[model samples]
Target: MGERGRDRSRGRPLPLGWDEEAVPADLGASTSRPVPGPGGDGEAASAPASHGWSRLSRRSRRLIALGAVLVLVGGLLIALPRLLGAATGPEQVTREFLQAVVDGDLETVRAHTQDARGVSTAALTAEVLTGAEDRLDSFEIRHVAVEAGTATVTAALRTGTESREGTFTLTSSEVGAFSPTVWELAPVALPELQIDLTPGVQEIEIEGVTLPVEDLLMNREEHAPRIAVQLLPGTYDISVPQVTPWTEVPQRALEVPAAFEKSEISVHDLQLVLADDARAEVQRQADAMLEDCAASTSSIPEGCPFAAWGTQEDTPGTWTLTSSPRIESLPIAAFLWTLQGAGTAEFTPAGDAEPIEVPFTVSGTAAISGQGALQVSVPAEDSEHYGYCTDAENGYITGVVVLEEPGQDFSSECA
Candidate 1:
């Protein structure tokens, strides 16, 4: 009956054990004890459970520690150089100033200057430092000696084919509590520009601003006028003003260097001459006018300086120019020009008689109209006359008449 009761108790549902105690398997030999219930007395109370760092994975803990170390290292790497630079001495400042000048850093150069009151960034150009930098292929500070708040730094400089040593002086000043001493450089003079003009040049102009010749000339000199002007560093467009009968000088733009004590520029003269294209155009118009004279059948065509005459009852003979027209003078002004040429005209009579050769001198003035066309004016004062055969009572008639001559007695010749 007892065995049956035990089996029946096992088969039945167990009661909830709120007061049970759980021990680790490694501590199985220890004494077994029952835990107090939720409403237990203070003597049997349970301690709160702990979730310490040992619960985290090993790799996760190691990664978090490495990230903190990397952050600290990166911050030091970024800030260490700036802290060291703030502690630079006067000699180091001078060396940095020279290096900045060579690199053409105008702002850094100006900042190191003793007095930058009137100096501007525009005035400190790369062109200004070109001469000095060109002379130095490479440079390094050799030695720096400081005494009584002043520092003298020696630099080893190299050129293309030469090596030299130079010294720079710096005056020390207090920057701030956290910063080291700063230095100021002495004032350096810019180069002078010498303008050498040609003998005929009387004046000079730069960028539309005219500079007086006397002001540019050197003082107490007996030679011809030459200018020596002190200029700040920059590029300038220079030219000579136009004098009468001479063309203006072409523009000459030059960059002035800061390191050079003296630089020279020579100016030349430009003269005006008649263009070949203009002369060729005038000659073409003169030849065209002479060709038109041969085609005219009037007693005297307006532009025809040489023409043949015939009787009224007979058909007019055709005239042909035997020689090419020549031009004597080219038109200088837009108004008028006189061209003179000599040509022969062949006149064919209406009958089967031989053609006669007439020698004539042609002179005419070419006027240019407002629309730029050539207007030929052949005056009557200087023209040739020729006699041609005309119909009369005689078996053959020859009449003499002056070409381009007004009110001539042609009736007597044909009678």
Candidate 2:
């Protein structure tokens, strides 16, 4: 300690706000001067100067230079490897998956998949083959992000190398988890459906989705996963009794013009079949209906009065099977048509009913039961003159009756 410093201290502590060594050299007078005090020894007294202040001190200068170099090197280091993960990137997996597919080695592809559902890639291959008619050719992996765990594989898919291009998005099961999985396509929406007064789905359309009808799979609702498709409508070649209710729907397979309005349609056709294995029950119902038909004559307003009931002989009748569900599933029902000598009785609308073109559905559904038009008709009349008459004198009776199950054969030619 210097003499002056000891005299000023007087045994108390001298405090400092900061480390003197860290202070900038320009922030104060050079540390080389001597301070003069009372009776001071005038001769300049010097202590050893730190080699850090001398340029000729190779050790200190080199140490500073080396420390600077270390800082630069540390700043440039990349931590990408630590953040992304240690696993292989999605691109490589996809590339290998494609190669395996080309080699027809599904087992290899399955091993590389990151399916979230833990679905076997081999199983996926089988499902695709079954659903797509087994026509797989090739796919090229365009990009893969390990962080995203998603790979975009752009490839020509076909039954052969001459395939077409289809964009597919295959992603891992979760975010930040690189588990590759197969692509799941969205449901091609059906149209806005107005289930008319007929029986089942009267009409359906995709609201904003303008998918072509040709691109749709036919008989969509027939199987497990229902698809929307426009079926060919016409008088089917098969017998009504031999067809499923879905197939038995009587639709005229003509392109519905966009200009056609609902009020412009006038007729609705329908098929009648047991909703399920309930044909026996429907037969009983038919018996009851017959009783009602016989009683409807003069007693009930809706009863059908055909004189001489009780299983009268089969009179001469022409019943062409339109998608016959069975020889006996003849869905030919009777609904009285309204007519007052054509135009003699001015038949004007009586209520708020407007006509419209429509496809129809009725009598249960295709799923749990069956699908088919149990009802179809021209646009309804809003008046009392042109409606279903149940009373023989003034009403149109429209109802359904099961004539037979799927086993009856009405194919016997008339003698």
Give each model a TM-score: 0.30, 0.25
TM-score attained by model 1: 0.30
Q: lDDT per residue, candidate 1, 251-287, as tens digits?
A: 6766544331233444432211223443465566666
**What lDDT score is found at residue 6 in candidate 1?**
55
Give candidate 2 misplaced runs (Cα > 4 Å).
Answer: 1-56, 72-76, 79-94, 100-135, 141-153, 168-415
Q: Model 2, range 215-291, lDDT digits (tens) per residue? A: 33222332121122211111111111223332332432222111101112212233334444434433344344334
Best model per lDDT: 1
Candidate 1 segments exceeding 4 Å error:
1-87, 110-124, 127-135, 175-179, 190-415
Residue 78 lDDT, candidate 1, scale 0-100: 62
Q: Which candidate comes out best when scored by TM-score?
A: 1
Once model 2 is optimally superposed onto the true structure by TM-score, how far is the C-alpha of residue 80 displaced, in angstroms?
A: 7.9
Model 1 gets an lDDT of: 0.52
Q: Which ten residues in a row have the lowest lDDT in candidate 2?
A: 338-347
